[model samples]
Target: MAHDAAYHWPPELMALLTDTIPLLCRSKDDVVDFLRGAGTSEALLGQFRQQLAVDRGAVSKYRIAREVLRQLNEQGDQGLGVRRALLRRVTEFEDFSTCWPDDQLKARGLVGQIRQVVGVKDSFTRMQQERDREHEARLADRRAAEEERRRRSALYSDLRAQLTALFPMEDPHKRGLELESLLNRFFALDGIGVRESFTLRLEDGEAAEQIDGVVELDGQTYLVEVKWWAKPLDINPVSRHMTRLMTRADVSGLMISASGYSAPAVAECERFLALKVMVLGELRELVLLLEREESLADWLRQKTRNAKLDRRPHTLLGVDF
Candidate 1:
């Protein structure tokens, strides 16, 4: 699954690259600029420049280019990207007319050689990508299933710990916050979109409404209100949620109660079902579903279905709808 970390250029390819560099540029200054632009170290270029000044005719520009390329090749993969860029740039030059007329054909030939090398590399890269795509396609479904199992298992473990911790939390406010966080994580685990508790402000910056969480399921938005009261949630809080739902057009309501719902509260939600879909949930049922490793998204879909079809605001997980 791993590729080689180093790229070793062949002796022939090195010679081709070195020979092509001088041809790609018209003068020694052009040669200096070309190497400098290709990311050659200033120290190396300085050494080349000093040598050129000392013995202008003794060391040829092609020889200096070869030395620079050789040192880069010794750097292995570290220099591979720069070398490839140089090769690509060499091949991109359209005019050899600036080259000496006698050496023009030779320059064209050297550029052609570099192009062939670059072309082979590109073809190999494309082939590798295509093969990787095909390989991934073969394992996509199984890998996705395994990844989902792992993800849900992790989420379940986290939620179970959070649930256990909630029992010992003495502060009702902190416990309510923890429960809202737990519910958000549970919904998000199965890929349901969730927005944590947020307060909507009025025009004067006063708090207009406090939403425990927001969740989107089956293309419908639901304003979520989570209550962890000791007694069964009565009609007052439920009615407040109903009033909030009334202000928003085409939005539904999801109310989760830790202490369960009183008959009147359930009846209140049922009344609101005529205007908007309202799905009520008990914390115990959610705990049970998590214990059984049930899908929260699927369960919500079923709850929404039952709410729409049977006009029932609440349904137990194990009970037949």
Candidate 2:
């Protein structure tokens, strides 16, 4: 019957029991007002006032509160039935024991006596339990959010340092090679597992072009092309790379151009957008992605999809801060 004791009564009923009853029980009109607020019909309000009058004749406001608490608890089990509507109107006033004069409460000890008989402490305990659960839930959410923030911040610090090392180059050709090697190290640190100088065999018993690098992600391999050229890339090199993409099965390409591409080169790539084999990006973009702590592979996948959707290989998405 412990479960039977719980009642999710209306806010008016709860407010009446907690705030208006003890202090207002002296007046039939005050109780009537509370009954109306709790959705009580006109018929029961008169009878409920009669019961309070009978109870009050013996003691008064404090004496009637004990029976009021019982009917409220019984509401969970539907014990009150039609009369429950009347009890619903029956409410209590806050600070009743303290606010009421001793004469109105019947006696100085009656407030404590009413609490003992009606088990009001049980309701208080349940309220405290609700507060405790809500407080703990809030704390758990804060802890999880903090943990995610710390993990993300730590990963960004390490990767940003690696990307920063690629800048302020003294030689363009050497920088391109360094960038290629840096990608291998970066992917390795990223836990994507890097393969250097990846090559495939052709039917003529000849080795395919010595590709710069390959990254194996989720059981698929991607050929990587890194270029730190001082000048904008043209269509010739981009076309050559597209030719290399046809030599494999279920394989895609990631082309990193530090200086970006020329207009003709971008147009040529857009022509090959249907192939769904390439994701074009710049060194500055990659560095910014690292600074933002976003997933590099996901970013590449999004750019690849964008090319397929809009046929604009050079378009970049804006990142929100």
Measured by lDDT, the strongest candidate is: 1
Residue-level lDDT tens digits of model 2 in 1-321: 133335644443444444435554446455455546655445544555776557645434433444454454555655355335544233222345443475445432344443443356458778999999999999999999999788767867876775676677677777667777766766665578688866667999698676888887767677788877779888887887888887777787778887889988888887777775566777777777667776766666677667767676675644332
As a whole number from 0 to 100, the lDDT of residue 269 in candidate 1 is 80
Residues 1-321, candidate 1: write the lDDT tens digits.
243345466677778888888876777767877888878777768887887778777777798788888787777877877776776678787888888787789989988887887688779889999999999987997899999898878789878888988988899999999899889989988889998999999999999899998999878999999998989999999999989999998888888888888999888787778899999988888888778888888888888988988999988766443
Clash count, candidate 2: 12
Question: Can you give the TM-score per candidate against the true fold?
Answer: 0.56, 0.49
The alpha-carbon lDDT assigned to residue 224 of candidate 2 equals 82
Q: Which ten residues in a row have the lowest lDDT in candidate 2?
A: 86-95
User: Ten residues in a row with the worst lDDT in model 1?
Assistant: 1-10
In candidate 2, position 17 carries an lDDT of 48
Q: Residue 215: error of model 2 in Å? A: 4.6
